[model samples]
Structure formats: C-alpha cells, structure tokens
Target: MQVTLKNFTKTFDDTTVIDSMNLAVNDGEMLALLGPSGCGKSTTLFAICGIHRINGGQILFGDRDVSDVPSQKRNVGVVFQNYALYPHLTVFENIAFPLSVRGDSKPDIEREVRAIAALTHIEELLARRPAQLSGGQQQRVALARALVRKPDVLLLDEPLANLDAKLRLEMRSEIRRIQLETGITAILVTHDQVEAMSMCDRIAIMNKGEILQIATPTDMYRAPVNKFVAGFLGNPPIVMLEGRTSGDGRFLVKEGTSLPLPARLAGMPGDTPLSLGVRPEHFGAAGANRVEGTISFVEPQGRETLFDVTLDDGVVLRSIQPARDDVVFGQKVVWPLDAEKLLAFDVSGRAV
Candidate 1:
C-alpha cells in the first residue's frame, strides 16, 4: 500500500501545525519521518492513523481516498514507542488478540499466532507475560501483534527508543529484515538519524510542520537541499562559518580565515554573503586549503578521535581522525580542508 497526504493541513486553537503538506510513501517501502522535537512528525503520524483529525485536504491509500475513514475502519496497524501490550496477557494471547477481535476460529488463531511467534524468534517466549519478557521480546510481541492483522499499512513511532544500545542495534536490523520479508508499506516516526538512515529506504525531513525534502539517506546527506537539512543530518555535525566571496576568488571567513573558493562556485559574484560548511571528516592532512589551529579538546571515541581545532581568530571547528597520540591538547597543528566537499549556502539558507 502507498500512503499519501495531499495538501493536508492541521491546526490547534489559533496555531496551524501542519500547513498544506503533500507527501507519498512508496508501496512496500519503509519511509522515515525524521526531525527534532515538536516538529510535527508525531502529528503527521497521528493524522495518518486517524488519532488526529485533518483540518483540510485528503489522505489516501494508493488510489483510494481514506480522508473520511474512521481510525478503526482504516486497515492500518500501529506499533507505539512504549510497546503497548496487555500486562496480564501471555505472549501467545497478546499476539493472538488481534485475530481474536476479528473472530478467527480457535484453530486458525493458534496456527497464526505460532507462525508469527516463530518468525519473530519468540516461540519459547509464548508462555511468558509482558512483565516476564525482556524489552526485546516484548517488542517482538508488539510487532507480531501488529503484523498478525495483516494491515495494509504499518506505523511505528520511535519503536526502538526504549532499548539499550546493543538491543537497539539488533532490533534495527531485525525490524528492517521483517519489513522486507513482509513487503508492507510502513511509516516510521523518529528523531534518531542513525535509526532513520539504517532502517528506511528514504527519509522525509520535516520542520515547522512542512515536508522539507525526501530522498535516499545518501543523496540527502551528500546534497542537502538547504542549510537546515545539512545541519540536521550529521553526527558531530558540519562546521558552518560565516564567510563571503572575495574578488580574488577566495572564500573569506569573517573570523579572519580565507581559502580558495571551490571550482563549482567560481561564477558566484564577489561579496556574496555565504555560509561555508565542511564536515568534520572532510578536514584532512593533505589539501591546498588549510587552517592552523591549537587542539583545545580531544575526545576519544572508540575507533576515532574528535578534535576541536581552535584557530587564531578563536573560532573552533571539529575534525575527526583515527585515535592516535601524535597531537594532544594545546598542541598547535595544521589541518587541510577538502575544498571540493565544502558546501556554500546563500543568505536565505538555500544551498548555492
């Protein structure tokens, strides 16, 4: 099933939350709605599942318009962040509950429940109640329950937020594998970039209740449509410094640093105010564009070290390198910038 929101609008009291948004989820693909808190991601999810009513426009399931359908009538299943489960019910009962509601025969219900239990690798856990099972097991039960109904669409809202680090990683792969095997069109609402990047086929970046951009993770990261999308997508983040094009074809940072302008920006007019951005990983040891800075901070991440490079003008930028002791705190060093990978944004925050 392909879910779509067309010119959808929603409001609360005097404020408009979602404003004339149009989006489509490809059939049998996992799509993620990624953004920071209060960005209307949850609101959009609720509107699709019918928890929140739309103020205008339409919601569609493939070619059929489901705009006026009630929540119960829509053939969609939701797996919530908390993994809503019945505490008193055993795993078998929990996974079987959905089919029971639809009046399936006892033999059919038992067969289906056991089948889903095997698929989720929770056959042994069928006898345990929610409280007796691990978080991962409970999650599987919730997923099995959602899938048992054979919903046209599956909605997951921060489904892995409750797990520990290792379990989260494990479940990310598990959910993605199950999604592929089932071929169900699913929507995931999450703020975690890794979860979105690792799990979804494409990501829809949202902010201020509007769909900013939608594309595969690689494309969105390599070529963000705007400054906000670029900044929001990376870990350790891209270092953005205010700069302007000098008549001599150089990017002059306001903090008294200058570098050769990228070849792609050669035709840009001089004195154009630009926001220069470079990822931490792009700063290296060999490039014509270089900056000398004192190491003010060194953070030892397992396999990589994140160094805070402070320039003479007191501006700080982060650089990532393999963990080594060649440079320490307060040591002066020169790091080259990969000018080709530097991104420039205009005053309006649009990429140049």
Candidate 2:
C-alpha cells in the first residue's frame, strides 16, 4: 500500500517533535527512518499507526485518509526494540494470541501460527517459552506474531538493537529475506547506520523532527545532499576539512593537502568558501591529490584497518586500508584522495 504523510506535524507541550514533514512510501517499497536519539523516528511511526494524534496534516493509506482511524483499525503491525513477548506463553501461544484476539477459529489460528513460525524459521522453538529461547529467537517470535496478521504495513522500531553483534547481523539478513518474500511495505526505525544502510531499500534521514534527505542507500552515501546526511550515513564517518576554492576555479585543501575537484567543478567560482569531505574507503594510496599526515591511531578490523591520521592543520582524517598494510601510529604518511570521490559543502553544510 502507498502511505502518504502530508504536512505532518506533532507537538508535545510547546515543543514540536515533527515539523511540517511530508513523505510518501511507495507501494511495496521498504523505507527506513534513520536518525540519532529523540529525532522523532518512532514518533512518526506511532503517528502513522494511529498511536499518536497528529497536530496537523493528513495521512493517506492508498487514497484513504486514515489519520483519524484508531490504532487497532489501521492494519499495521509493529515490532518493538525489546521484543515485548509474553513470557508466560510459549512461542506458539504467543504467535497465536494475536489471531485469537481477532476472533479467528482454533484451526485457523493454529494453521496461520505454524505458517508464520516456518517463515521466521522459529518452528522448532514454538513450544518453548520466551525465557527458554535466545534473544534472536525471541525477536523472531515477536516478528512471527507481527507477520501472522498479514499486516498492510509492518513497522519495526530498532527490533534488532537488543541482540549481540553476530545475532544482529544474522537477524538483519533474516528480516530482509522475510520482508522480501512477503512483499510487505515495511518501515524500519533505527539509529544504527549500518543496519539502515545494509537492510533498507531507501532511507529517510531525520533530525530534530525534520526529514533531511531521502534516497536509496547507495545514492545517499555516494552523493549525500548535505554535510549532515554525509556525516550520518557512513561508518567511521566521512572526513571533513576546512578548505576553499582558488582564484582560477580550482579547489584547494590545506598547505600540505592537495585533492583534485571533479572535472565538472572546474568552472565553479574560484573564491567560493567550501568544506571538503571524503569517505574513508575513498582514500587511496596513489592519486594525483594527496594529504600529508602522521598516523594517530590504527583500528584493526578483520579485513581492513581504520587509519586515523592528523593532517597538517591538526585536522584528523580517517582512511580505510587493507589489513595487510603495515601502517602504524606515529608514522608519517601521504594519503591520496580520488578527486571524483571528493564532496564539497558550503557554509550552511549544503553540498555545492
């Protein structure tokens, strides 16, 4: 179903939680609302689900304005961060409870519950109570319960936050698989950039109750509309530097830093004030543009090493290199920058 929020606004007391926001979720497409804490991601979810009354605007579910509809009547299923399962009930019983509440017959409830259990790969744990299952299993049960209803739109609010690193990775794949197989329009609310980037079809980045940018994960990362979107989406984050354009329309970094601008930017005003940004992975060992710095720290990951280098101006920059490289902290190095990978932003943080 296509869900649309027009002129949406929400307020608590005198503070507005959601400004005049407008967004549309295309039919069958998964949209993730990503941001830092208290950015109103969950509030927007609840507003759509009819849990919170909107201060303004209309909400349409495929041409039907359901803004005034009650939460139970919205046909929306929500999975929360904590996996709010009924500890006293077995997994099968927990999954069956939602159906029972809707007045389904004994046989129908059992059949649907079993079907959902199989889909979530929790069939073997059906007879176990929540306490007896692992965190991932319990979350799966919660997911099964939510999906058993065949909801029009499934809303997940940091559903994997409680799991361990490995389990979170596993569940991300599992959730994406199930969502794809079911073809349900899902909205995921998460603060984790990795989770949003890895699993979401597209992401709506929010801040202080406003939508900053919305795009597919790749586009959002490769071409962020502004500094906030650029900084928010990437792991290790994008590095920024104070820089400016030269008189001949050439971009220049600090004294010891030199990075080419994209060929398309050759004609831009040379005196324009700008900031330089480049993703960690975009840093190279051989390129026409380079930055000289001393390694400040080395973070070793299994497959890559994160290099923190202090540039000439004392600005720390990050570079991701292969684990096989022998670069170490306190070592002087010249890191190359790919001109095409450079991002330029103005004083307001908007990309130029």
Candidate 3:
C-alpha cells in the first residue's frame, strides 16, 4: 500500500509534536523514520496507525483518506519496542490472537497462524510460552502475529532495541528478508543510524517535529542537504570545523590552518564563515595537501584503528585507518584531505 501524509500536524495542548509534515511511503517500500529520541518519529507512526489523531492535514492509503479511521480498522500492524506479548499465552495463541479477535473461523485462524509462524521461523516454538522463549524468538513471534493478518502496512517502532548486538544484526537481515518476501509496505522507527542505513530502502530523517530530509541511504550520506543531516548520519560522526573561505581557493580554519577549497567553492566571497564537515574515513596517510598532527590516542578496532590526533593549534581530530601495531602515542602523523569528500555549510547550517 502507498502511504501518504500531507501537511500532517499533531499537538499536545500548546506543544506541537508534528508540524505540518509531509511524506510518502511507496507501495511495498520499507522506509525508516530515523532521528534521536523525542524527535516525533514515533508520534508520526502512531498517527498513521490511528493510535494518535492528527490535529491537522490528511493521511491517505492509496488515495483513500484514513485520517479518521480507527486503529483496528486501518489494517495496519505495529510491532512495538517492548514486544507486548502476553506472559500467559502460548506462542500459537499469541500469533492467533489477532485472527481470533476478528472472529475468523477456527480452521482459518489455525492455518494463517501456522503459515506466518513458519515464515518467521518460529513454528518450532509454537507450543512455548512467552517466558520460555529467548529474546530473538519472542521478537519473531511478535512479527509473526503482526504479519498473520496480512496488513497493508506494517509499523515497527524500535523493534530490535532489546536484542543483543549479534541478535540485532541477525534480526536486521531477517526483517529485510520478510519485507521483501511478503511485499508489504513497512515503516521502521529507529534511533540507530546503522540500523536505518543497513535495513531500509530509504530513510526520512526528522527533528524538532519536522521532516529534515528523505532519501536513499547512500544519497543521504554522500550528499546531505544540511549540516544536521550530515552530522547525524555517520558513525563516529562527521567532524565539523568552523572556518572561513579566503576567496582565493582556500579555507582558513579556526586554528589558523589554511586548506585549499574545492573548485566549486572557489567563487565564495572572501572571509565567508562556514562549517567544513569531513568523515573520519576520509582522512588518510600523508600525501599532497596533507595536514600534520600528533597522535594523542590510538584505539584498535579489529579491522580499523581510530586515532585521536592533536593539531599544532591543540585542536583534536579523529581519523580512522587500518589497524597498525607500530603506532605510538605522541607520534607525529600527517593525513591528506579529500577535497571532493569535504562538505561545506553556511552559518545557517545549510549545505553550501
């Protein structure tokens, strides 16, 4: 189903949680609503699922406005963060609850529940109670229950947050596989950037009750529309250096270090203050246009090593490189800057 939110607004008393937001989830697309906590991502999901009423605007499911539809009438399934499984219910009963509540026949409910249980790979645990199941198994049961109804849209609100790191990774792959296999439109709410990037077809970044940017993961990372989007999407985060353009194809950073500007930015007026963002991976071994610094800290992270390098002016920068055993503290190191990979933002935090 194609889900559309046009100028959707939700407010609590005098405070607004969603402000005239507009978005669309393509038919059969798995789009992630990604942002920090209290960013109104969950509120938006609730609005779509009819759990929260919108104070303004319209919501459409394939051209039919469902803004006034009741939660149970929307044909949407939600898998919440806590799983919400009943402690006394067996896996089979829990997965069959939705069908049973709707008055489906016994044979129909049994067939549907068993079919979805197999799809979620929880058929073997059908006889177990919620307390007897592991975290991952419980999660599968929740998903199976949600999918058994064959809802047009599936909503997952931080569904993997309770799992361990290994299980989270495994479930990420499982969710993606299920979404594809069933061809159901899915919306995932997550604060984890890695999860959003690795699982969804596209991501809609939200903040302060507003939609920031919506794009495929690659586009959102490679060409962020603004500084906030740039800084929020990366692991280790994007390093932002406050600087000013020299107008002579150079950028003068705060510490008095001048680096050449990209050709596209050559026309910027002289002394135009801006923020330069660079990812840690972009910093490499010394080469032409290298910046010199001394290693302040070295962290070996399996395949890569992270170095905290202090510049001559005492500004510390993080750089990621291949893990090396010979690196020592206080050792001078030089890293080259990739002009193409650098991002420039104006005082307003908009990408230049």
How do the predictions measure up, each by TM-score?
0.97, 0.95, 0.98
Q: Rate the local accuracy (lDDT) of all candidates.
A: 0.91, 0.88, 0.91
What is the Å distance of residue 49 in model 1 from its true position?
1.0
Off by over 4 Å in 1: none
- After TM-score superposition, the amount by which residue 151's alpha carbon in candidate 2 deviates from its true location, in angstroms, is 0.8
Give the runs in model 3 whose Cα sits over 4 Å from its true position: 285-288
- Candidate 1 vs 2: which has more lDDT: 1
What root-mean-square deviation over C-alphas does model 3 reach? 1.1
lDDT digits (tens) for residues 1-352 of candidate 2: 9899999999999999998899999888889999999999999999999989999999888898999999889999889899899989999999998889999999999899989999999889988999999999988998999899999999998999999999999999999999999999899999999999899999999998999999999999989999999889888888887677775646666644545676667677776778889788878554677777899988899798898888776778788877945776799988787777778899899987
Q: Give the local distance difference test score of model 2.
A: 0.88
Which structure is stronger by lDDT: 2 or 3?
Answer: 3
Q: What is the C-alpha lDDT profile of model 3 across 226-322, one tens digit per residue?
A: 9989999998888899989988989999888787777789888999999999788877653357888899998889998988888898777778888
